[model samples]
Target: MKWPWTLQPFIFYPQGGGQNGDQGWLRAGAEEWTVTGTRLDKASGVVWHAVAGELPPVDTQLSGEVDAHSRLRQMARHTGEHLLAQAFARINPAFEVAAVGMRGPDCTLDLRGSPSEADAQVAEALLREVMVAGPLTLETQLVPHTELGRYPLRRATPLTGDVQLVIFRDTAGELFDVSACAGTHLPLGNLAAPVTVLGLEHIRAGLTRVTFRAGPEAAEYLGEVYRSARALAQGFNTGVAELPERVEALRSERDRLAAEQSRLRAALAAALVTAAPVEAYGPVQLRVLSLPDAGLLPAALSEVPAGEVRAAVAGERCSVGSGVPELDAGALLRAALTVSGGKGGGRAELAQGQTQQPEQFLAEVRRAVAEKASWSYVCHSRR
Candidate 1:
């Protein structure tokens, strides 16, 4: 239900300008309603409180309480966003805010220009410096729309009538920022919680989105990151500081071992190919080899004798190679696997696939070879 109580003395902050609405409870006599969210009717200039429960009688006196802790965090994030935007602006004027969202777990701001890594670093550093410099005061003032030119705003506003200016200044009364906004804000001192940049990504053409967290949320995010890094480092038997080096070393060692294994497989394949018996069938020579290592299949197939069709099987995988231009290795293998109900394909010179029944696949290949070579002559020899 909508509750139009904006005119009365109210503590709830209506949702506007990228800030979340206040949530709490409203009570009158023995009845109470949970204020889920508050929203402003921008077109009508009316604030509405969305409630969950029975609606109270018109003009019934009611008391409301805002969730102070949640409000405080929200204020911190809002002010932090202002500080971050200012820092980025200081780096480059083109880094103007195109859009913003702060109602979710993490706050985000879309910038008009793409910021480099160095720009982001400098912006973060500047933000940190301003944050820890000293206690800064955040104040608001209602100014006529005509007088808005007196303040230098980071972004332009389309608001008419009275504009609420959220201003921040240092302890020495030096102005830091002034913008037209109705969102809640906190003094820089009260918002001394850590701020962290989560990441930056290109959301669209000529626009970059920056995701970040502030206050207790940022502290929690940092804590989780540390815990995950520590766990990974412990697995590698090293400290967090040495984790990256340890991972790189392991990758290098893996590559070295892989190269040595490939060399050994190639040598063994050459020996196997040298001893393999060739069967003669009419005008064609055929060779079938069953290898223990699938890694050796490619090397073994590469050693095929001229004018011979070779098929090698390792585990479930099989490879076929042909040196004769008249015979199509891929076509033969495709027919054989088709008969055995397996799946594979390749070019005329080479083909590869897998089958559950290796013996059946080999038998099909042998039958196909016999048909192609005819029954003119048959013999076996190794040379």
Candidate 2:
């Protein structure tokens, strides 16, 4: 569960205001416990450190060490969100900061009103300009609740007692932002290098969520993207800048080849149908044929005269069509597949299916047609 640290002089920051808590270790003598997360009990005003392993004695004088890397990452993301929110506000007055999320690797800023692609681009440009303007000065101040109106706040403060305001100013003492916040932020300097927006999506009807990354995290992402692009370009034997053009060219060639292939298949189907010989079985005239491509089955069957029954096989695929009402093509094909070990079905006039045993499938169709059409036994035996 959690260990309460309410004694005095706390070093760990608890999870609050949408930012994650400090993660580290607490040790007293040789006994140590790992703190996975920290949270505040708002009702009791107690900060609880969630830990693993055994808990130390209540009075043990344990010292804690916060994980510096994680803290810095959290700080960078939180600061970047603040600056980006202000940038959006400057772009349009309607784009108010509705909410902020800093729990995960990527932070999100939710704006009150939806913004177009152009508006988002302008906001990102403004943020880039602020990031390169040298180290900014951050000032945290405690002011009476009623005196909050003195400073220009980006939003109304929720705190009822003394309000904590984080103020940002450029080198020339020009104020950039003043907002009431409880989250941990970078004490000073740039809001990490290479802060950029990832993308945007509509969270609701009027709200838009902007995903972004900053500092070391952003650098790592950009590095991976560059490596992936280089690998793809090398596979295509082209430079990274020319990869898109090469891909478009390949797609065009594929379409042209597909159209030519369709034309060739139609010609082959017509030739196969014309070459097959028809055999007379009592009142039924039957024609059997084999095709090279399964896709040509429909075209071949369509060429058969209305006076004849046709059965054709292409690889594992087979089709049977009955022109005479005495033979049911659907029932005939179903019986054949039962012995051939594959599956398909169609109407009585036309039926198509796949079977592993092509010879056995065709023989089954021939035998069934002979029996259903009342062909002379001597004639069936001769065929």
Candidate 3:
């Protein structure tokens, strides 16, 4: 259920404008409610809180707490994104910030103008230079909407009410960037170092999306990569730089072993055909076999004796065929499949199908065969 903000100063920012809503606990003396989610109403500019347990009475003096760790991490990454955007614009005058996202540990930027890998590397290098170059100063100002044109704004202002402008300035008071935003951020964008461009992916017609990480998350990511590289080098008894050749060799060896295993499986299936017992069923010689691979049926049947009737069940798949042209093996297969909830069709001498239950397939085949044998006996007695 939703709790309206009219009764209290629910100053907690609701999830909107690319920032996630705050999550924490709201306490009133001895009772506390866990706030799991929060949302904002665009039409009414109202904030709503989604909480667990019964909310305290209206107008109850509740103490609210926000998860500062999560908030600060997101704030730091957002500031780093602003720095990256500013650097890109300085390097390429035509660069435009199309869309940006910095939530949790994910930081992504999409640009209408395509940026090559080299261009991204250069932008990253420029960001690193400023990272070491003293912390930047930030100032916020509130001014009338008509006076927004006096500064070099990133984009035109859409809101006419008192707008908040966040300005990043170097130590010398020169402006790094002037953009209108309302999210919490660090005083210096460079404080969220060392920001790096992960990679670039071509989204569509001239648009490229760049993924990046900043602050502690970036350090953790690079540490994981280095640890994995060291582990691989130790496992292969080679240096990290020679890992590519060793990995390719291992892949080649794996493929060769897989091929060898397949050849052995096929040979084993064919051998089973020769080992099956020959049984008499009225005028026909029959050999029923169960195997693991249904695809091996054709190869196994190639070794069957002439004039022998065959039925093979492998897992949930089964097939039947006869060397004797007079015997309608296809009919027998269909009759068996019916009992097993399966489907099959072929010439009167051969048929194939799959069964719903592999364990019941053999029993169904035996019943169909016994019924056919009984009918044969009745027809011969009438003759």
Candidate 4:
């Protein structure tokens, strides 16, 4: 589109898919108009904007205004994509740009190749050079299809008639890429600010999707991430740089405590076996051990002899651990289940169960263990 002032021409084809539409005002002398949307009119071979409010009369000196923030971000993402594409080209000459679209605060360039870390690094370096140089120049030209073969054009389909191309050049007049493009672009290297690569992904076997934010969007995204990390550090009373170490320390502490609890349970299991009273269904081991903070039943079970000891522990709730094989422990656990109605299962050699009635589970365990000795019996009360 033509601008009244000495401004570079803009092709309204947007850049990225994830980025949003551009919004800005249009000014013609005293009257100011708002441009709500922009689209390519294929029939007319021109970009048309959906203008709001009254527009200036035809041939009036009018200037198209773009959202500075949005434009800056678009440039950053677009340039970043160029850098990434250039890097991929260096790695594999066969790799080429499939398509490009700029949206919102980001831009996406679909590339055809499996990019490597070296390629990414090269792209980053190229992007850094653009940012350092600044103020890009974009020139558009129409060349005949016959002339396309002379330039290093990356296109799958053959061109017919005349084709529109965008040429990106830096302050030193170094050419970046010359391709048929419809998106708006920054002058040469003048991107308002540098672009940063946020992330990259392999979208398909042969295609790569690079996600990047530029200018204010990049600053904003990074700022939020920093704030979260700082808050986490503050919560742990540590420096921001030390947050990772602090988290690792907390994890290590938890693991150590778990190991200690396991050891204590094993010792308690041995003690419960030695202090049981003998009864009819083998040694009726009834030991009301004060439950530790963890794994009370397994600890108690480990102490008792196999098939001879049936133990129960009372804590925040009640739990049963037995050493008897082929016994329907569920049947024995029914009384505990009736009071609290919790369920659990394990191998025949050792079964465990939980119930909310911590006080009543001890009496229930004693009764359930005494009644059954075979595998087929179901715990009628449990159901």
Candidate topping TM-score: 1
How many collisions per candidate? 0, 0, 0, 21
Q: Tell me the TM-score of each prediction against the true structure.
A: 0.76, 0.72, 0.64, 0.61
* Whole-model lDDT per candidate: 0.83, 0.82, 0.77, 0.60
Candidate 2 lDDT, 1-383, residue by residue in tens: 66755534568889988899899989888888888888888897778888877777788888899999999999888888777778888888799988888888788988887987788889888877876776677889988889998998888876778888988887678777788987777877375656778889998999999988878898899899889999999999999999889989999999999888878887888777778887776667887888888898987776456667888899999998887665778888899999887898998788999988888988888777777666544556689
| lDDT digits (tens) for residues 210-308 of candidate 3 | 888888788888888889998989998998888899999999999999898778877887688778887676666778888877767776655445567
Per-residue CA lDDT of candidate 4, range 1-383, in tens?
Answer: 43222212543333233344466777777788776656544565455666675556776666777877666566666655555565467567766777765665555667777666557667767656765765457788888878887766545336588877777666677766666654455664445344556666788889877665655676777788899999988898999999889989999999999899778777776665456555545434334544654455665655345655464555544444555554544455655577656766554444566666655676666666665532123443345
Ranking by lDDT: 1, 2, 3, 4
**Steric clash pairs (candidate 3):** none
TM-score of 4: 0.61
Error of 2 at 89 (Å): 2.2
- Judged by lDDT relative to the true structure, which candidate is superior, 1 or 2? 1
lDDT of 2 at 351: 92
* 1 against 4, candidate with superior TM-score: 1
Better of 1 and 4 by lDDT: 1
In model 1, the Cα lDDT at residue 323 comes to: 83
In order of TM-score, best first, we have 1, 2, 3, 4
